[model samples]
Target: MARIELLQVADAVAREKGIERELVLEAMEQAITHAGKRKYGQEHDIRTDIDRETGEIKLMRYLEVAEEIENEATQIPISEAQERNPAAQVGDYLADPLPPIDFGRIAAQTAKQVIVQKVREAERARQYEEYKDRVQEIANGLVKRTEYGGLTVDLGRAEAVIRREDLLPRESFRNGDRVRAYIYDVRREPRGPQIFMSRTHPNFMSKLFAQEVPEIYDSIIEIDAVARDPGSRAKIAVHSNDSSIDPVGACVGMRGSRVQAVVGELQGEKIDIIQWSPDPAAFIVNALAPAEVTKVVLDEESKRIEVVVPDEQLSLAIGRRGQNVRLASNLTGWDIDILTEAEESERRQEEFHSRSEMFMEALDVDDVIAHLLVTEGFSTVDEVAYAPIDELAAIEGFEEELASELATRAAAHVEATNRALNERRLELGVSDEVAAIEGLDPAILVALGENEIKTLDDLGDLAGDELIEILGDLAPSIEEANAVIMMARAHWFGDEEPVDGAEADEAAEAAAEEHERANV
Candidate 1:
């Protein structure tokens, strides 16, 4: 081809594929190199280079100067190489210029295939680089086609896919129709860069709100969290940096204009715009809106909450098919349990009676004393046993003598319970080493023994979730569980000393990575 024609072809291919012209030129050089190898001998070290400015092509063959020539085609003796260039060293490569290749029918076709493959690879790389960082942003595109219940969108620079499940329920798009979707995922696969889009993602709603609400886009108000049922209902938690601005009102707009814009695009999905609070209890209360909450009890350790509402508000609070509570749970990152007022009252009374009876039996006290103990926030015998003498004596109708007697009884009761648990653990064949693990009390040791996790190695072999399951309600939080397991595992390493929670997790992760490397 002519020099001008070479540059024109490269420029045209680059423009058409939206790739760099230099990449296209490099592919052309590679194609020509393959042709040169075919024309001469494949065994020879053939290469081709093209001048970027003038588009001049050069074909050459390289032979390495070696002390001894192993391959006659690609290597030459240092003595023979010295004749061509006296300064040539043993590792130096000498290039010999060759005539341009004459393109036969077969050679032309092979060159075209090579160039096309290289150009396509470059194009895919370009698309991946262009769209990878755009993930989580909204993309506007035209529907190019529909195949197997999914839409192939032409995004101008790249193509994207919205699977049927990712589209709003019952929403359909025909060819050439404009569609807006969230760029949820972008991945480089063998075929090309696959850009996955979605309309049902929680962040899709969040990004739509950002586009519609100027305050959110400006960072004056922020979308703290979002939960969606997709096409049916969604909830968004908004927070304002400025005290003067109401986040809910800003998101709702005047007469619900801002949120309605988003709802229309979402196939009329109902939206609940709630103001976010740093306090989890207050946040959860706001999350279950339109239905009044009578009380909220939080178990911070378990990341769970119990919401009590009026009997008539039960259905509303739970929503249809438990959607309201489900969305609230997702939004606040807490497990929510809903109960009617009557149910909560009955449960509370049952707990009070249970605690009173335990106190009466454990401390050898009367109903009045047990009731006072329960009222004074003494649920566990350990709390009474270890509590300050002054604190117990300060309770109304209780003197120092009575407080001392109660504390003595509580301590004896706790000691007896621990002794029984320890005896049971021993009977179950639980090792003393396992019992000595930090955070493993006698009750936990008995529980582990019951599950046949009787040895230190047995406890160490357990994953966090497995240990949690075996212990049931007596199980610790995941972090604490992992720490206990690691402490139990310390003897496996050179250490019998205990490690803290953070150090334990780090050690576990390092061990896991080491195991993975060994397997690989």
Candidate 2:
């Protein structure tokens, strides 16, 4: 009768907590196991089991039968084990049934704690399993409490947090207020499964639109990208699979009803819906809405775009505090430089004159020849110095001999520039450790010396992005920067001598020649 009552209690607890009946029974067994250990010696290997069907409790002391008894409390020799069970043998478990423990007040409290702790662990595991796959999903929760500027939300069976920074600017919630946010992360922490919710995340706006717009929900329209200045303004780029339907119009809905619904949820944040385009330039133009673009020059190598707008539209294109261009850059993943038509024209003429001067000074050429070289897209002395004789000769008014002379002057000028830089580098007291790094040229070494980075350790201490920022135009790509930093750091591992940059090059060339000779 008592065993049946115990089974009914387990079922009731499981149904109340929305957990499995077997888990509740297991918790009960664990609690009883602790009580058994407290009653018996703590050194004894104690265990407890509760039958799932009948909830009959069984407490036992586990002893491992061994040829020699090493542990008197938990291990017994086979002869001693055979007295209790005649068929017992070495390397066998000898489970001795223990008398049912009548819990005192202290023991009962300890048992209750064990059961509660086990139930809490099972609950946390259940929450983590349920929410881990739901990351990036929108969840509706009620604000339960606020702690240190962050809100704790009750998500039905589980709880979530909206950190203060993750909340939109100036947004506040009462204890019982309902909130909708994006589930950005779920982590299994030592205390419990933590569900991190965010209202400031850019995707939260897209999810709100997804909830309100049937076209987006049905997959006829897709949200390509989203950028937000939460509680102030946002931009969303959308594309439509069906050419007949306009994605922006569909998101805006009848008389702005759909977008207004999302805006209300975001606390009056303004939204700009733009059509996504395959061309980055076209997409950037669309992203900067309400301001006309006169022209867009893209530098694909650097992922930067220069936009020329009318002088009157400059303020509009840049927005108040440069918000429009900033959001546009974020949405299109391009660094945007906004310039008025007059400003762009002035910059263009200045660049043209600068390049012409560089060609005339480096190649010892006349103005017309320099202008022609600049027009032919030879921007630097190095470009002219390395160009093939045929390429330079192909320029109008340049014969083979003239092209060869121009290349020679360009090479001489570059060599002179390097020699001056190397002299300056030595005068700055730059160490050979920094100079020996593979990609650190004389000019870059001078720059590093001017910045007080005179040692290899100083260079190696910098992150790749930090090195790029320090070197400016002299910086290598991020991959190359990391490689150079690693090369500088290689000496820290052992007594191996650092390779000089020029010596390393000669060694590589020699290896290549040896390979060719071996093949021959």
Which candidate leads the pack in lDDT? 1
lDDT of 1 by residue, 1-520 (tens): 8998999999999999999999999899899999998989899999999998898999999999999878999999999999989999999999999998889999999999999999999999999999999999999999999998999999999999999999888898899999999998999999999999999999999999999999999999999999999999999999999999998999999999898899899999999999899999999999999789989999998899999999999999999999999999999999999999999989888989999999988888899999998899888999999999899999999999999999999999999999999999999999988888888889999999888999877787787889999999899998989988887767656754646666777776665455456558
lDDT of each: 0.92, 0.88
Candidate 1, RMSD to the unseen true structure:
3.5
Mind giving the per-residue lDDT tens digits that candidate 2 earns over 39-69? 8878999999888776688899999999877
How many residue pairs clash in model 2?
0
Candidate 2 lDDT score at position 393: 99
Q: Score every model by TM-score.
A: 0.88, 0.79
